[model samples]
Target: MVLLLRQRGRLTADTLARELEVSTRTVLRDIEALSSAGVPVYAERGRHGGFALLPGFQTELTGLNHEEALAVLTAGSRRGERVFGLGSALASAVRKVVDALPEGHRATASDAAQRLLIEPETDLLSRRPVTEEVPDTTMIEVRRAVLAGHRLRIHYAATGQPPQWRTVDPIGLVTVRDRGYLLARRSGEDRTYRLSRMLAAEELPEPAQRPNQVDLDQVWRERCAQFLSSDHIAVLVRVHPARREDLLSTAVAVRAEEPDADGWLRLEVTYQDLWHAEWALWQLGTSAEALTPQSLRTSLHHRATAVATRYGHQPESRHLLPS
Candidate 1:
């Protein structure tokens, strides 16, 4: 409430109540408590009157030592800053934290934070992290709505689909593997949307009817469980021992595995879908062979045949360039 008053200069009780999602009575009592606790809080009662903090009134976060301050800086430096669209606010907070630390410890904390690196452009294996791009305008409104417990409307376009407008009661926001998602409810059913897919967003004035408390991690786990159990394709394969890891990494589940007389590892696996199973098995090349599901074998054969025929001297299809 103090921060709100500091930002806006003055805010009416009704406005404060709406912004803080509490009753005006609670707001008034909290203001009283603040005043009793030696804060420079004051209220004006009349038309066009409201609560306002004294000019230049501010508060510092107390009791955080060097180590804790450094931890905050390092975490703020992470992909989360960009993922959650809190980069500017985090920068401001870090500045205040540095100002609060003792002058002697401030420089040390800053230098140490700079030395700790995470998710560098190129990892040790030369693999680069994939960054999903989300427009700042869209990300900011979505983040605001979720944090403020307000309804959100988005113009979103999912892969291979037309853009459509949707209104959801946003419950939480999540970032995983450098991608952002909004967890919400649409017409009473749970929905998850990729932040990068949001073309535009608007925060509605109406409050969201979400549960007061939520275990976001549990919700995410349940969603994952449902996805993994849906439309799975079971298959059997024979894989060379040397290339076993390549085969297992892409599979959703390993149903069974046994050694064959030919010194190969015969394994039964499940994949997310037929396409997933075929693509994963195809990636193994000659090192692994699909043993069941004739359809998979046929699809692989057709793909290989197309590749071979394309390279084999098919006459007219090849373009003849002028020498």
Candidate 2:
């Protein structure tokens, strides 16, 4: 009621009741309550007048408790705003949220939110994930196209390739792991584009060709399955029990798994290619061993031999050796 009056300047009791989906009597009772609470609510007896708040009067938010306010403040601290190029807008919105809190809870909630961190800080112990830089203009256009059901012309720069102009039907936006993606279709084929890689974008006059309803979660899963099944090599490996999670995290897919007699885990995993498999297994050191595909084992052996030959050479000076 306060926000409505503040925004519209003044509203008749009938208008307020109609907008709020309540009875005029209810609106009158609420007005009395607001006046009793020291709010600057006033009514004009003339038909031309209605309820109005005094100039410069703004109401604090009364909906949130202290914990809910703290949660909102903490969520506002996340790095998600950087991904979509809304940092400035998010900052302004956060300020408004803080200002809306009750006087007694405002300072305490802000102080508590400052103590909680969303993403890890860059330090020796942990490396922060690099968030992609996207232009505000590009994101704004892409978002507008998606929301308005319009086709978009974009200059996309794929990895190891020059930027190419393509017209894609905007479906929806997806954000994964601090990276934003446009889940759209081109020429009736599903296309996914990274927002950071978009060099330029413009909305088209043609209506987008898309389903009436979209289930983005299911679409994302289907796309992931299709990607995993394309141009991937399968390898069987034996991994130490302690390093099971390390292998699972690195592999593209886990096809099969079982425990060996020696208490190690025997599993079949998929990788993008031979080099991908080699690199993943190499990182595990002796904790993981490539069992099948003689080619991978040979490649690992050759790489290890090269490393050994490079490091095994004796130094020319004995003084360089540690005591």
Candidate 3:
């Protein structure tokens, strides 16, 4: 209401009530409360009369200390703004936070914040993270439904399948590693939907069925563990000591690790499927070797032979230029 009054200038009780979806009496009572709190709110009596703020009135929000202010500013600098569909709102909030800080601390906080960076474009290997494209309108509706406790119907495009519409009881929205997910229940069964795969969405009039209190962190962890454990295949490999960390990072889990006779580390790791195992080992090149599961070794050998056949040729016989 304060923002509305400041933006529109002199809104009547009826107008304010209509905008806020409340009664005029409630609006009058709120105005009185604002006055008692020294908010500079006043009402005009004559025909062009309504509530207005005193001229040059600005609310001073002085709740944050210097370090707190810098943390808030740094958080705003991160792409977390893009995750929750609050980019513009976050920008406005940062401006208000800076404006509310004391003059002496403001410059120091702002300058210090500039020295920190979050989620840079490229990682150590110059590999950029792939960002999924989500429509703004779709995200807006999804967030609205989640906040308002309303059920949602979404046109979802799952991997290896065509798009389909589904009605879900939205539990909450979670952002992980630059990707957004809608954790919900469909037919009393827990389900997770990727926000990037949401082709379109609509908020239903009916309220969603969800627990009164939700621990999203716990829920996400459980779901991740379940996903990793389902339909998985484990492999044993001997990795060079220097490349052990690389192998561990790519594998879902390191089941066992021990030193072999040649001083290399023999590790057992789990992959989601055969293709996943093949692809991860291929990226390691000669730094690692597959020990067990002769199928994996054969697959890699066949792939290597294919590559050799394609590239192993005389320079005169090979036409490198595109025709």
Every model's TM-score: 0.60, 0.64, 0.65
Overall lDDT per candidate, in order of appearance: 0.81, 0.82, 0.82
Candidate 2: tens digits of C-alpha lDDT, residues 1-323: 77567656789999888766679999999999999999999998786999999998976654544433433443443455566555544444555566676767877997898797667666344656667888878988987788789999999999999999999998887776677889999999998899999999999989999997999889988877787788998899999998897898689888899999999999999998999999999999999999989999999999999999989988676565678
Predictions: Cα RMSD each: 13.0, 12.8, 10.7
The pairs that clash in candidate 2 are none
For model 1, residues 231-279, the per-residue Cα lDDT tens digits are: 8877999999988877877887677899988999999988977799889
Worst 10 residues of 3 by lDDT: 65-74
**Candidate 1 residue runs with Cα over 4 Å from true position:** 1-78, 232-272, 286-323
Rank the models by lDDT, top first. Answer: 2, 3, 1
Where does candidate 3 clash, by residue pair?
A: none
State the TM-score for model 3: 0.65
Which residue runs does candidate 3 get wrong by more than 4 Å? 1-78, 236-270, 291-294, 301-323
